[model samples]
Target: MSFTSARPEDLLIDAARRGDVPYLQQLLADGTVDVNVQNGKGFTALIVAAYDDQVEATKALLAAGADPNVQDVSGNSALMGVSFKGYPEVARLLIQHGADLNQQNGNGGTALMFATLFGRHNIVPILLEAGADTTIRDVRGLSARDLAVQQGNEEALKLLPQE
Candidate 1:
């Protein structure tokens, strides 16, 4: 990504942010815009769409061959973003698109950790069912269940596997 503000990548990012499917498809068809092009923050269109809860845009991006496992500068994948945001549908989309359920971020936080820490109970099961490892610990030596316990997220705690 260059410093140019008017670049097609910028437009693509904005289009995904707004869930503008037609415009997104048009840009993808132009062949100049890389579907995985990242902004200054290393956020691709797919990451933006999934984080913003744009289900259709996310699906379109996946259909266009977006890498669901692409991480941001912080090593946060689209799955982690949606898990924290409580977008269950978006989470499922990424999972179906081959998102790594247990991929950790720079902080060693997985999607399950984010979901549990953020009170996204719905995402916890989705991740667990997809085979997320509860034993994975973050930089703080906290697992998803530990986060749920700290956050007092009873729903998440109940859903989590016993240690």
Candidate 2:
């Protein structure tokens, strides 16, 4: 897929950020815009949808074969972003489509760690069910459960799998 530049893909991404599902769908169906195209920062359609909290857009991108595990320049995947933002449905969809459950982000934080740190108790069980590594230690050797306990997030602590 050749292009004059990333202009067209940028427009498609903007539409996705605004939750313009129809326009995004049209652009995707037209096949002119690269479904997996990343912007200057390496954020794909799925990443944009997850960032903007557009559940339908995320689902569409995934169904269109967007690689859920693709990372941006900063190594942030859609699952990590969704988990951080506490978007359960979107996270579920991404996981259903094979998003890496144990993928660590640029900061060496997994989706489980992000969910726990952000107090997204609802997202923990989902991540665990999707096989997120409970024993993953970040650069500081802090697991998700450890972070939750350190932050005094009792809710997240209850949701995390015990060692």
For residues 95-123, write the lDDT of model 2, one tens digit per residue.
88999999987778999999999998889
User: How good is model 1 by TM-score?
Assistant: 0.96
Compared with the true structure, all predictions reach lDDT values of 0.94, 0.87
Query: Each prediction's TM-score against the native?
Result: 0.96, 0.91
Model 2 misplaced regions, further than 4 Å? 1-6
Model 2, total clashes: 0
**How many angstroms is residue 111 displaced in model 2 relative to the true structure, after the best TM-score fit?**
0.5
Question: lDDT for model 1, on a 0 to 1 scale?
Answer: 0.94
